[model samples]
Target: MAIGWLSILKAVPWTDVVSNAPKVADGAKKLWETVARKKAPTGTSASATSDTSSPAGQEARIAELAGELDRLQQEMLASSQLLKTLAEQNAQLVRRVYWQSRLLLVVGLIAVAGLTLVLLR
Candidate 1:
């Protein structure tokens, strides 16, 4: 007749154990803190705690990030507008160059025709 391990585990006073767990955890935490406090160096822990933990510090950081985002957005808009303006100017320049070349070709053909007529006579 083996006393099964599962039956022994189930026989535990689970409610009483659970009720005392928090007190036990608190004691252990305090004990660990005391030991760690003795070993840790001074001033090192203070600097590791950041200002962003507080509400006002968090608000300031959010505002700074928002301002930076706005600045980047405005810069992007300005650069895109400048790019559009440059593209328009480039298109106009291309049209002007194309027409100038056509005009020069027409004038050269007319000059060659006049010289031929003069030489034929």
Candidate 2:
């Protein structure tokens, strides 16, 4: 019953989850196969104990840290993409301003040159 609850909870259907069901199932199957194929963790190992301050608790903590690390990496990547877009937009704005100012300066210089020439003639 707990296993069934876990499957349903993990399938939260968040975002593109609806489209990912098949892939998620395949990944879960692969995880089970790999774990089952491997030699079972020896009971003699320190991590076998579930006591307070046990190695198993430390391993679980590390796994949790790793999951958070993965989520943070994804968030950083998204933020980088957004920052890149904002930088491009800012650069385009600067370019537009530079060209507009250059154009005005050129027109002003040409008007001054033309007036000076007319006055000399």
Candidate with maximal lDDT? 1
lDDT of 2 by residue, 1-121 (tens): 9997774454343444445446545655555554455444345455434442777777876786687677666556655655565565556556655665677689999999999999999
Cα lDDT of model 1 by residue, 1-121, tens digit: 2566654445454565566557556655654554454433325244334766788867876886686677666556655655565565556556655665677689999999999999999
Candidate 1: where are CA atoms >4 Å away? 1-49
Clash count in backbone of candidate 1: 0
What would the TM-score be for candidate 1 when compared with the true structure? 0.56
Model 2, stretches more than 4 Å misplaced?
Answer: 1-52, 114-121
Cα lDDT, all candidates: 0.61, 0.60
